[model samples]
Target: MKNLIAATYAPMHPDGSLNLGMIPSYTTFLQSNSIEGAFVNGSTGDFVSLSTLERKNLIAAWAKDKPKDFFLTNHVGHTNLNEAKELAAHSQGLVDAICVLPPFYFKPKTLESLLFYCAEVAKSAPDTPFYYYHIPVLTGADFNMLDFMKLAVEQVPNFTGIKYSQYNPTDFGKCLHFDQGSKNILFGVDEQLVDSLPLGATGWVGSTYNHLAPLYYKIISSYRNGDIEQAKLLQQKGVFFVQTLDKINGFNGAGKSFMRLFGLDMGPSRYPHKTMTDKQLALALKLMEPQEIAPLFNTSFSVKHLQAIG
Candidate 1:
């Protein structure tokens, strides 16, 4: 509910098993660094590859130590309606909100079916806020903003926000139109927050934020304080960092390696997704060492001061 600068968790273990031990440390690390929330079992967390129980366990483990004000947005999306609903019920008290993407395989369909799918999860998690995860490119369901507006007013009163990941800025703005109050539009692409923020987005949900939270906070706060140039500079730096990772085969693998390098015990990404190679690691180290972005990992840097700069 509070303005969130959230990180998408990356489930990392050598055997593709969920490492429960690393979660507490990771939560503590985020809290210590002033992160407002986390999105567990999302794309960055490899939710598609995890079993039902694995996803539930990760959420429970994180809920145990998460700070009171630090919200958790559970990504409860799947082809199975029962599975998604059950997960929504399981996450009722644990998470602040439940985010569901349209059924992936049954896509390229009508808006009616998409709304029905979202409505099921929305009704299941009546108490928790429901945020639609609108990433059509990945799911094959192209949802327009006008349809979302219609649904929000009719079926789902708990429809509090949306995680719009598509690259279209105009469509993103259409999602922000609400007569009652401001809808929480969380930008899913980490690199585009600079452009997205001024358009009325209050929160961000992205994988890279797991390691780059400090920089993100800097950019968001700068923009909020009316320093667009400063925010743009920081956001540009973030895009450059993301572009560097783009050259690599996997972002999750590269992100975990970055976390490990900075001393977080987050292990290697699960199997099928290879860990960063020596060559890739060497390039990442070089790109991340520059002072402009290096402060992300520096313990001495104050998040408030970084927000105020420029």
Candidate 2:
């Protein structure tokens, strides 16, 4: 499997609509700066708010612009299996893999239900590599890593790996060590890549990677190459940036605003998710400027470039 430093989504317009035009430039920026891949229509993409067609459009647009070697994982998860399956089918030839979070809203009455859901999804995306996305905090379903192992090995034949998003390093480590043969465990916390790497995390999927791709690539590359000190320093800087956003009520508004500052006309976030004020924007710029981090505002690269690098 190709290990990668991947972002979660392309930014959206202020009206909360998909900003298709920004994708090519954004993918180019990722390629020029060493970002290895991206995961679209995931939580960071606000999948919950978008319609199925919109999600398909986003995936199609990305597939068109993304470098062939730049692995793209489409998050086709939905509360309804039919909808999720439809999206998965639509994205079949468009992406490298398909990641689906466990059914949300409805708590599974038994392990069988969860396993059944996985089986269905696996059946739907027969040709696509299917990864189980476990983010218990958001879904209210606490899926133990052991249970997931059983589900993948015995029940879900097409299941290839997981995007473990819970914040517990030990759990992530256990999952990574569980079945290293065919199962891949991608660390989902942006701020914990350095700590997670040593524990056997080969890939990562996170929201902050959208704006911090260059830095993330540097850290992951350093760790993979045995440059521990460099990785640690980069991780420290990442943690600092993450903390800064946390202070401003997390990355919701701050991430979008930072995208705007970088020149993607990604409009403000939708209502219920407030957009940053002038003071907040000032604070964000001040916090990021010293780090010398330039957002990929208008760069363009093709999937061919990514394939060549690979």
Candidate 3:
């Protein structure tokens, strides 16, 4: 939570089965890029598409291979309350923390009901720190997080804070200052990260961090160094990076496919998410090169190709 925590992709084989074998390499890649942790089974992992057993298996694989220092938060959210608790219980000792999105389908009508649901899931993993994944756009359960946290802290003993993914900076800023900044309110929007920094956002969880950690770190350093213009410029690159991939194919699939540029073949996107063709991928790289963004990709990419473009 101190720095960037990647919302990891679930590696799959061509057949779309869980390619858990790729996890060890995935871990090394993240650590190499200085990503603080992995937020598994979240949006980027396509968790809803994965079965309960598949989600459990994915967490187990990450836990088994993750380096001692790597922080892993298993997103054990399920529409079914029983299954969510089951996954929470399963993640007890394996992960550094456990996270749960509000059940998206039925949707919680009131903050009290949302609190009830979170408290139930949190108690299932009593010993592990619990985080409420507040992504209202997808969940359709939009509650004021600052108000919810005021109640949640009193209700749920293990409730650490929120993964505030929505675009409400005023509320996000309030949540950050709640109780003099006691809770860990991780900002979830990548494009808005630089803006969030001035609002006291220290931690972030996003999919872009997987491919562009170096660029982001540079952004952070530039901001810290008082180079505001450079920071803004770098952040715009991030925004453009996401937009470019999103244009080639849906960003979720194209971005995951872009991992191959780092030498980690994360494989095809499952149903409903388009996998980029080789030509599409080449176009993605081509699009990034002129923006001066390609140079910031991981060193694992062919230096020759990068230089040739340079």
Candidate 4:
């Protein structure tokens, strides 16, 4: 959880089967861009649709050539506690960390119950650093993270921190500074990631990091150098990237397909998530070119595309 962790996609063939072959190229692509790690089977990776074996295969493939300094986290969250524990157990000697979002189906009603669920899964893989994926917007377990961590300290032995995907800056800042900076809260919102800099966030786990790590790193440097305007503009480009792709079909599928522009063919997305057409992708690149967010990518496209495309 140190550098930008790309919330990776489950590569697929056009027929909607798992395309495990794309991972090596993907790993090289991320390393080339300084992305540092892969956050597999999370929301971006479409964990819910994957079978237990599929998830395990993904972890194994990505873990094969993982660099010593690279960070690799597998999202082991599932609707079934048993399945979650199974995945956590599966990830035991593989990933650097194992993360779990609250079970969205049955859903935990209270923070304590959610912590109870987390503790159960964490204990399965006692050696792995466990992170609670605090994405309340998706999971409906919208309890306070600071409160969660406080209880976690007393409950879960392997509890590490959170993959906070909410937008509450105050709560986020509080979590980052909690226990005299002992909490390991990785910022999740891409548009407001720069705000986390002053709060001392060195780690982030987000899907957009898959596409915009360079731009984000530049934004961080710009913010540090007092170029607030430049930083704000870059952050806005990130927002623009989301808004644009989201408009085409939906951001998840469209963005997944857009990875082709970077040489990683993630192929088609799974059910309920529309994969982009060639015509659609062409239009997307055309629309994106006007934004001038070139530095956001490793591609030859210039980072100076848009100043106010918003």
Candidate 5:
């Protein structure tokens, strides 16, 4: 969690069935490419589209005898409180942490209501550390983290941190400094990660990190060495990577398909998510080539070969 923790994609068959078999290779790929951990069954995994059993299967596969340092955080939040609690309870001995988006459908209006939802899920896995997934765009629950930190600390005993995925630096800064900087606020926006480093962010969890770990590590190194131009330039490649795919066939769908370029074919995307054609992937790769990120997509390259070159 200290560095880039990839919010991993759901591996699937052509018909969109879960493909657990890819995990062994998946683990090896992440390790070799310098990805520290995974945030499993999350937005990147299309958690909302998955059934309870499907989600359970995903957690089970990822949690089963994983490498000791290959941390797994399960996103067990569900619209149905009972189902969420069940997932939370089921993940007790399996994961390093559990994160939950607010119940987006009905939505929590007050601070207490949000805490109540989190408390229930937290109670189910009392031994586990609880991280509130604070992606306001998706959840529509825009409760201020500064407020959440105060309330969560008082009530949720295992309230460890937040998967902060918004653009509001003011609230993010407040949460980061809450209780003298004890909180673990894992930044979630891949495009804006460089902005967080100056704000004292140490950990990040994001979807693009799955494909661009070497690039991000390079961005971190560049920024730390007072190389702002290099850092910004690297980040723009990610921004372009996302923005370009988003235009052609939606980022999630095309991006999932783009994993094939990285030696991990995640299969076709699910409903409301389209699969990118080979032609589309070719177009995407063409754009990435100039940025020098195209070569790092495949695992055939060695770790020694992965020197960041953007």
Candidate 6:
């Protein structure tokens, strides 16, 4: 079975404060939906908009209540190297793994520079598995992972693999085959999952997994069962799911708000990320109805009951 890690949202209060109280129920929701893991504080979590202290508190809350058999990969990448290291150290004994993104503002001009940044952070958590976040569309440090992995294997003692979010199957394929497939390269593109299937993607981390785990696993099952057309059809529904969220407000905001329909209020997105009103959320759900996507949503957990226990 492929490991499906959901890139979780930073649950907040209506006042834009961290709602650490919501995490226990959040875990229940993911576990009930059959999500295998969580990739916290990554792009979907709005990491850049959060203060360093806030990020620390959020991950700590998650660590305190992690379910048995749940894999937590805390993303500790920051624009500031020292802060990133501090987060890495904080996560050392708390999470199953740690990952870092290249500094985006003064991005690494060469592969060596990026590897050096990863090395410094990896040293902070020497005992934990380390993964380099390769989302060049956001970081602008788009070095080929095939080349990155070659040197990373030789240099970074704890370097494990990458969270590949880009759309380069050729490079991803090569990396998957490198060293006769030792490293754990998790695919990060949700909609392009069907495409990565042929390349041997055994692990995936993405935001849509939060709401669509069953649909995605079905896509994989269909493919492995030699039903290629059914797999493609299901993957198209995944694409439609993203488009529906993107059309209403924006993906980050609307998607977070959409969680409420499943009984988990993710609160509002921070500045620059659009938030939808109750009316807008209704419209988003209605849009999903035509694609038959809305029927597949998970609504097994209750936030209110969880909060009462907490």
lDDT of 1 at 284: 65
Task: Specify the poorest-scoring 10-residue window by lDDT in model 1.
Answer: 301-310
Candidate 3's displacement at residue 21, Å, is 1.0
Task: Give the TM-scores of the predictions, in the order they appear.
Answer: 0.88, 0.85, 0.96, 0.94, 0.95, 0.95
**Candidate numbers sorted by lDDT from highest down:** 3, 6, 5, 4, 1, 2
Ranking by TM-score: 3, 6, 5, 4, 1, 2
| Global lDDT scores for all candidate models | 0.75, 0.74, 0.90, 0.85, 0.87, 0.89
lDDT-best of 3 and 6: 3
Higher-ranked by lDDT: 4 or 5: 5
In the order shown, the candidates' Cα RMSDs to the true structure are 4.9, 5.9, 1.8, 3.6, 3.5, 3.5
Q: What lDDT score is found at residue 43 in candidate 4? A: 92
Candidate 6 off by > 4 Å: 299-310
Q: Write the per-residue lDDT of candidate 4 for residues 17-127, one digit (tens) a residue.
A: 888888887888888788878999999998888999999999999899788878899999999999999999999999899999989988999987898899999999999
lDDT of 2: 0.74
Judged by lDDT relative to the true structure, which candidate is superior, 2 or 3? 3
Clash pairs for candidate 3: none
Clash pairs (backbone) in predicted model 4:
291-305, 291-306, 292-305, 292-306, 294-302, 294-303, 295-303
Q: Once superposed on the true structure, which residue ranges of model 4 sit more than 4 Å away at CA?
A: 300-310
| Model 6 vs truth, CA RMSD | 3.5
Choose the strongest candidate by TM-score: 3
lDDT of 2 by residue, 22-124 (tens): 8887777656655678888887777887789999999999999877678888998889999988988898888898988877888676677888877887778
Which lDDT value does model 6 have at 194? Answer: 95
Which residue window of length 10 is worst by lDDT in model 5?
A: 301-310
Candidate 1 deviant stretches above 4 angstroms: 2-4, 277-279, 289-291, 298-310
Error of 3 at 82 (Å): 1.0
Give candidate 5's TM-score.
0.95
